[model samples]
Target: MSTEVKLSQSTAIRLEQARTKGMSDADILKAIQANDVAAFDAVSEEDYRYDEFLSYAADHGENLEVAVQDGYRITFNTRGGLGIYLEKAFGVVAEKDFAVGEGIITGLKLKPEQAEVLAERLASNWVITESKDVPEGKVLTLKLRALV
Candidate 1:
């Protein structure tokens, strides 16, 4: 089966930024077109484990999951880390008390640039306030609007 991932408009822009940062346009396009992880990693900065993290699998019987922390939406996968989420209350955030990964974070307002920076560091589909899914074999958790 093909394990390719399509790029969202934001992701495409992110790739474009990396390509313009000195990488070869041809190579960038190839990675985007094929959804190549290694290709993306080549252009990404060091310390970006999101690719591996994205493919990671949490130990069995774990609550590990990926979530948009404050957002009601969550997913169950094998990744481990923090995911950003939107709370019911506007501009409100809450850090969930997770077991494996760093907890969640809420009420922290970031500018577009800040979010972009975080996106690079996280290498996630989107910024997650805190997540441990995929790595933990569970769905995300955004129970409340208060810090864990």
Candidate 2:
């Protein structure tokens, strides 16, 4: 018996690029068959955007705090520390967070750069706003409003 699998346009482009780089057709096919290939590898990393969270929020209406013209608003509070906050907010803790002091992080708004980092975990179009400043030894509250 024989089987045929269709390649996506992006994957086809990747296959061609690999061939141009001296990879054999048999090798490329073997890699694809083994599921060891990544389509994004052929593209620029800077161009990738994560928007799964937006889709989920849109479909389920879970965190509909306020509806903006293009998206909705959601909020997150952090009391323990950046590590704890990241784990709770995005479900992943980065090594850099561990290196930082475990002291409580309060009123820390998500910067544009930080948003990019968070997007890698929970892809969403959002803007972070600090509703109130964190007093000494207080928790941080952040308002994240979605954007189209």
Q: Please give each candidate's TM-score.
A: 0.25, 0.22
Would you list the C-alpha lDDT of every candidate in the order shown?
A: 0.34, 0.33
- How far is each candidate from the true structure, as Cα RMSD in Å? 13.7, 16.3
lDDT of the structure predicted as candidate 1: 0.34
Candidate 2 TM-score, C-alpha based: 0.22
Q: How badly does each model clash, as a count of residue pairs?
A: 29, 2
**Model 1 — which ten-residue stretch has the worst lDDT?**
62-71
Q: Candidate 2, clashing residue pairs?
A: 106-140, 107-140
Q: How well does candidate 2 score on lDDT at residue 146? A: 33
* Model 2 regions more than 4 Å off: 1-6, 38-148
lDDT of 2 by residue, 72-145 (tens): 22233222333443544433344432222222223444444444444332212223222333332222232323
Candidate 1 Cα errors over 4 Å, as ranges: 1-32, 50-80, 83-106, 111-148
